[model samples]
Target chain A: MDTNPLDNASPGHGPVVALFVTCLADLLRPSVAFNSIKLLEQTGCRVVVPLQQTCCGQPAYNSGDYESIIPLAKQLIAALEPADYVVIPSGSCAGMICHHYPQLLDGDWRDRALQVAAKTFEITSFLSDILPIKRGHRAAIKLPSVTYHDSCAGLRELGIKEQPRQLLQELCDTELSELPQTEVCCGFGGTFCAKMPEISAKMVHDKVHSAQTTGATILAGGDLGCLLNIAGRARREGVDLEVRHITELLCGDLDGPAIGEGE
Target chain B: MEQHSDTFLENASKALGNKAQADIRDLLGLFTPLLRNAAVDNFEHFEALRHHVKRVRQHSLDNLDHYLATYEQQALKNGNRVHFANSGDDLNSIVLDICQQHNAQRIAKGKSMITEETGLNDFLQRANLDVMETDLGEYIIQQAGETPSHIVGPALHKSADEVRQLFLQKHDLGERELDNTEDIVGEARQILREHFLKAQVGIIGANALVAEDGYSMLVTNEGNGDLCANLPPVLIICTSVERILPRAEDATAMLRLLVRSATGQSQTCYTSFYSGPRREQDVDGPLETHIVLLDNRRTEILASDYREMLQCIRCGACLNHCPIYNSVGGHAYGSVYMGPMGSVLTPLLSSLEESNALPNACTSCGRCAEVCPAEIPLPDLLRDLRHQETVEKITAPRWRIGLKLHTWLARNPRLYHWLTGVGIHLLHLAGRKRGSFRKLPLAGGWTSQRDFPTPQGKTFMQQYRAQRKQS
Candidate 1:
């Protein structure tokens, strides 16, 4: 009946954020992990990426296998004890870890879910206002025209907006193209692409069409799944566009070949 | 079940779902955060309205025998006769019988997609009934002999030129060419006015049925539903079972979300709550009113795992925001409902065998969950359906074996490591400095179009183990 919907204020003693570098960031998109580090560091609070950290068991949890997720959630909560914050990168994983984990652990797990929910914040959010950053120190990075996409978890579960764009807007000469029907999902939904490849393909196709229509030379987003799907399609059509993590553009460490160059 | 065209899925897959998933990560960029911001901004609870509406529907369905009896009594009290339809045929017969009794020569309809679903017009026309559509969009699609692409915005998929061509070909115009949206709309308005005044029966779809007061809420942008219900001697409102709500206030709250999410409007141009037939003192309303609540397996849907599907108010907001519907358009869906809601609903509303392709039509990216007024978990539900589809063995046998093998290998770390190591090495050897594969075995559907980037050489487990030992 009563789960406080929003985290309107920071704790009196700034909450200690325990970083859960979701399996994707820990393994593939380590740069997301690193940039997340920079964002947490900007907060000027104790930020620790726990060594025992692993997957949020979302894949198994979403697949409707509760048994697998329970142990992992227990281990996660135990590994980061006395923690006031449990910040994570991926929206889907963070949402599952925060909302679903407690359900898996019925009795005491509800309290833990409350505990985790109280502290967990997506990277851009923590930096945007919580641990206030310098008013505006965006470095200039010359680049082709670009647009932004919001991930599902961050959009629906985490309520994240403006933080990434606030950061992106600060970077100089970044001509961000406005997406028509920008809030529509690209359909990379974790196991969804693999499960319903055909339907997933159509959604990505539509996303590419929107991007191409905007004449934005780049597609930028915080989440990897959306970018991966869109980039894959662009790679197929050989569209003259680059896809980069918002962090990579912010950090200005892009080393990959120009989109469609490899082809 | 009629099999899907399969091309839509194919084209979409080429765009979003493929082996390129692991390598790229920007697709989730815009939609995810836009919704997050919207929710944060839109958090004051309209829970009372939701509860009211839900109960209204339940109340009407429970005392359906009583409500039907009372609705009949009320309409009759207002000098209107009531007709009940147990099935589509029965409804068609009842309508036919009334039109025959009244000798209704011209029938003017105002955007009743429910009629299209029930094949009502077809039945009437087959019996030589003269039916005329009055709404600009409905009139255009009627002329073209095509079904509506969207519930609220019929003929949304059509460009002005296409509509112009249809009107020019069908409408009696000496030499004038129809140009612009206003011109087409004006042309239809001119054509339908005579039919509205002359038509004996006007059929409409109620946005909601209020149980508290025995009134029906019908809101329209052009005031077509009003004209259809008011000017005619007989008015027929055909609505699904779930449209009933407890109170008019709840309808107003639902209207707030409905109009805003659908078209960003505070309210429709014409919002009216009609109770029973017209009074003698009333300026104008139908002499006789009919409210037909069609079951059509809706009762079955309510009892199933898909009860939430009934929560849809048919605002077409999901379609308005759906990526799949935005391209190739709605005719491609081959069903009345299209987009996220359509993908879930078509199967439930119709034969699953034929409409099975609808559920599989989602990318499950979860954007549909963001803009939903009723807050339906569309992406998650779609994923659940996919799991059910696999369980039902509706998927091909080869897929079953493949998924089983993948799940098996994933469960076993030893085999998973060995297999992935070999797979990554082969991928590296194949692509090497090339950085991508134009083609790969088993999943050539992806590689044929795009390159699959070779792995970073060391697996995450290997990197993690080495780093751990060093620490």
Candidate 2:
């Protein structure tokens, strides 16, 4: 994959974007974060990774452990506060900052949360909404027919249905075959897969089936948690489809194996 | 009736494993959303109507006391007896007293989730009254001796063949072949027709209670509600107090959203508004009319953050669209109200301790809230219930301890990073060849169902820091 010429430009060329590498991306799949940085850099934005950022506090928030997540939320808000824009590679984490932060904090903290929320955008939406790289600037990525799974938080909470598709089609010039039940959950609800594994299995089973039915070799999505879940299940089910985060495919960073696949 | 929500996980697993009912649930999952979307797409002003009705529902619930009193007074003026029951048991006894006072033996009933919630039929049966469900779906489930697996389609869990067997086993219809859908309906119709004519008392649930005029609105596809309300000598309308609205137009506006969401129809076969009993000039109608309002936990719900839940109109849109509902079906919920609405309301009506798992039995997909005509935030309410669970320490100690450890680590990022770094590196080394783990210790729940993906060699932070130094 050829690195975009613009990506080599010095930092501070445009708006400063603090990349919020979500916990799953940081721990499980760093390629998502790397590709995300490349995409943002290609858009002429100065990308900064905030090391103090640990998580968006969703696991605690979703588990009803509000008391535990509040400080983490504050820590994240403080960590990403200085950036002109906070771009998350994952929609679930982005939604957490943009939507749940205001609900989680109060008073001055609430105002700060809203301020940070106003500038936070999921990676694909950030590229499409904040900095739309026209056709001339698009990277020449040759991908197989791609199908997408809309993560629940991103689809319903943030209305991220068309952003990734538009990016894939416009940027990579790839054929995007639509997955049936694209809006349905992939059964990786943070801790839900562990808490109610049976139901989660059924949901992921249905999701993998739908993806397989699409006949697309690659199933791409905005959130890594969902990708890991679908890819993990698809691997176990002996399905041949490759699961990837949309960022990885978009940036043509395919040297590493697909999710749940070894070299 | 019995709160089995505590056993939701086990119940869901059983439902998932059962091929027969799971097939039906899978079919419902596939088609119900399509039907709802088709109806919504066809209606040009579905969103506008939904918003308007949401306002109507919110306004009604906000001034619930005022509307309830106005309705009762107006109902009394129309010669209809209005009674309020503080609890489910209270409501059951009130209905029983009304039945006994009239010496009612055989009773015909329409589909009423409220009655199902109160276990009214079982209570009345204990009193030795021959009560029969008049609605085709309710009648089938009544004969099969099963609680409703769904609010709209009570016996939907049963296959057509299952229903055929149920009819043959329960009905004394000789050796008739109930092989087809039409034949099944005809058999049910023939049986229900006899009970509708013979029953001295009839009971039904109202879709909405118009407070401005003493009228109760009911929408039914089969017109069974009309038969149950008008054919008997005495009529009883069983409904919750939250069904009240300020005006007739409000009820009709809500009806527009309700019908479309519930069954994806523009209108039901019968839309009846009962304004008390028969007039002097009326030829045929119920001689006595009684309206029973049950307040199982409406007042408490109205006063809490979950007040929005009371705005629900029982459209079953949430149930139809829920993935969790699709996975396990309604019976797994172990309550009359199942699916997303039940997940929120069941805990509020009963103690959270009794139905804690019901709330957790969700992926928080927000599809329920997306399709809810009343616009109640089902996921948010479910989350609040979980919050309540944690605050009360109703959750398991091991789970809380795990959360606390994670929280403590999260607050201290250095420790979190160090620990996560070591853990990721270990996992990467262990699963380097396989790329994933078939069985992970302490993660059996996940590994049992799906493989756990291996971490890429180094943590992003570790790699990022190293790259930054090189750059």
- Prediction 1 TM-score vs. true: 0.79
- C-alpha-based local distance difference test score of model 1: 0.65
Clashes in candidate 1: how many? Answer: 26
Clashes of each: 26, 0
Please write out the lDDT profile of model 1 over residues B1-471, one tens digit for every residue: 122334445444443433343112133223333443464346455444445555555555565556555555554555555555556677777778878888997887877656766788889999898898877778877888877766766765466787888888887778886667788788888888988999999988877766556677888888878888889888888776667665677677678767766655655799988776778698878888777767777778777777777777776767756655553345656666777887787777666556556666654556566667676778766656655666666655665555455544444444554656566556545554654556667755444434554443544444544554586
The TM-score obtained by model 2 is: 0.97
Winning candidate number (lDDT): 2
Query: Model 1 misses residue B329 by how many Å?
Result: 2.1
Candidate 2, clashing residue pairs?
Answer: none
- Poorly placed runs, candidate 2 (over 4 Å): A1-10, A135-139, B1-3
Name the best candidate (by TM-score).
Answer: 2
TM-score of each: 0.79, 0.97
Candidate 1, superposed: residue stretches over 4 Å from native: A1-87, A100-148, A165-182, A191-220, A239-242, A246-263, B1-76, B83-86, B180-183, B281-285, B395-422
